[model samples]
Every structure is written in C-alpha cells, then in structure tokens.
Target: MRIESESAKNQWVTAAFECMLDGGLRNIRIEALARALGVTKGSFYHHFANRAELVRAAVERWELEGTDAIIALANREGAPAERLHRLLGVIAGSSAQQGRGELMLFLEASDEGVGDAVARVTGRRIAYVAQLLEEHGVPSGLAQRRAVMAVAEYHGARVIAAGTDSLPVDERVLDVGDAIRFLETTLLAP
Candidate 1:
C-alpha cells in the first residue's frame, strides 16, 4: 500500500500523530503505521523517506498548529493583563491535551537526532510569546526571560497534572496562572 500522492503523505502524518498520542513516539513504527492506515510500508516510504522524516513532519505540525493558535489568542488587542491571561489559557489548554506522558516522550525525541529541528520550531514559539510580552511594553531582556519561564512552567504543570488523578482542574489552572502572573509582574515589570 504505497502512498500515491502528497495527500497520502499527510495521511501518514495524521496516522503517526494518532499513534503517538495513543502510545507515545516509541511505539510509532513504519509497519504499525502502514497497517493502521491500511497501506504498505512502501506507501509510507513514498511519502516519507523513513521514520525520521515522518517524526520531523509530526513535530513540525505540532509546533505550527499549537503555536499558531496560541499566537492568535495572545495577539488579540487588549490590556496587557488580558493578553497574558489569554496566553496562559493557550498554554494550559495545549498542555492538558498533550498530558505529561506524551510530553516526556516528545522531550526525549527532541534530544535525539530530531533535537535541532524541534529546537528551531520551539524557538519560534518562544519568540512569538516573547514578542507578545514586548508588545505590552515589557523590557527586551525581561520579555525573553518571561517567555522562557512560561514555557518551563507549562511543562512543569503537565508533569504535575500527570502524577495525580486527584488533582482538580481549578488547582492546575490556578497554579499555571499564578506562575504566569508572577513572571509578568516580577520579570516583566519596569
């Protein structure tokens, strides 16, 4: 079941994402993907040269889609506080969907051969967040720090969320918001 066209490449990428979300990236194998799509390994190769290529595509899609959504929300013309709230919302929402386990898998993948590529996309996301902070008149240095802190806190929240079945949604959201606010006030303040 060789993938016949560019559309088929997209289908393979979609299947790969579903597989990763279901069982993490380690479980994403060419044969498994092909079987899942009712296609042959050759079909996958027709679209992606190999598993690495497919993984790169998946990471690109994740960053592009997630970053785009966050940027759109954060860019809404509003008070600085409102913009920050919306930015936090984007982080919380995306983290909730990704969960801790999936993120750990992604982080591990990021350290492998795919690290540079993932870093490039992730750098863009961070820059976008920093840009929003700067738009609100945050100093350049402080904006950079806050942007990095925001990313770190988001990842930390995912870890915390994953560990406790008893963790309430409000608690997690509050924790995330508090961290963002603290950064905004302390780091981004003049």
Candidate 2:
C-alpha cells in the first residue's frame, strides 16, 4: 500500500492538512498521520526529514493550494468586482476554504513559522484586493482599509453561514455583490 515517490510527499501533506482541520497542528503527529493514512513512519521519512519539515511542507502546500489559488482565481476573468465576487462565491461556505478549517489556520497564526506564512497569505489577499480597488481610482489608504474590512467580513460571513448547519456547504452562497458594492463600488462612487 506504500506509494513511494514525490506523490508520497503530497499525500503526507494532504493528510497533515486534514489532521490540522480535525484538531489544529498539535494533532498532526507522525504516528497519528500514518495511522490516519494507513502508512508508516518509514513512508513519512521517505518524504519529509522530520515532523517539523512535514509541518512546514503542510503549511506551504496549504498556502499554495488555498490562498494562492484563491488569489489566482480573483486575478482571472472579469472586472475587479466581478473577480472578487467570483472569489467570494466559492468561499461562501461552499468550499473547505470557508469554514472552521480556515479559522483554525488563522488562529494558528501565533505559531512563529505558521505566523509568517499566515501573514504572507493574508497580506497577499489584502494587497490583491487593494490593488483592484486602487485600479478604480480609490485612494491608497481607503482601498487598503476597505480591503482589510472585506476580508474580515468575508470570514465573518462564512462563520455565520456555516453556523446555521442547515445549508449544504455548496448552498451557502453569500451574496458576492454585497462585498463588491462595499469593497469596490462605494470607493468608486463620486
């Protein structure tokens, strides 16, 4: 059952991500991850040097797979507001990116290494949002402020959406227009 190769590294990282979602980083023990994946430490060490390396790799992978992917989504197709709206559309509790997992990841930002990664992701998201706003003649400071606010609201909306426990994740589409209007349009309003 052991798949020996770089794919093993990816499997380990993916397992680590799921473990982190289950109980944050502390639950991501090598033995436990192996148990969860039905692998062994031998399989793990074949990919990562140690637990710390695994943790680092997990965060990097999450950064690339989550925030970077979202930013890339935002950068594609349509105007800034439309792009932002599309980004919000998928996150409105419809995806893994929209629930307790992300909150846990944000909470884990206190960890030194993870903190740097978290900051990098958050800053990139805000900077990208701000860039879109700035493109519309919004002042730099206001654009930045709105961008931060937008992110906060985005998370808050997800919390509320997920809290209901009634809507299927895919059905939890928070209105992207609200975000676009507040974050993008209002700034452009004369």
Model 2 lDDT tens row, 33-124: 78777787788888778887887777787788777887787678887667766666655434544356667777765772578888888888
Positional deviation of 189 in candidate 1, in angstroms? 4.7
Candidate 2 to truth, TM? 0.78
Error of 2 at 140 (Å): 1.7
- lDDT tens digits, residues 5-116, model 1? 6578898887776666555567578988888777877887777777878877776666666666667768777876677777766666554446643575556675546676
| TM-score for each of the candidates | 0.76, 0.78
Determine which window of 10 residues in candidate 1 has minimal summed lDDT. Answer: 93-102
TM value for model 1: 0.76
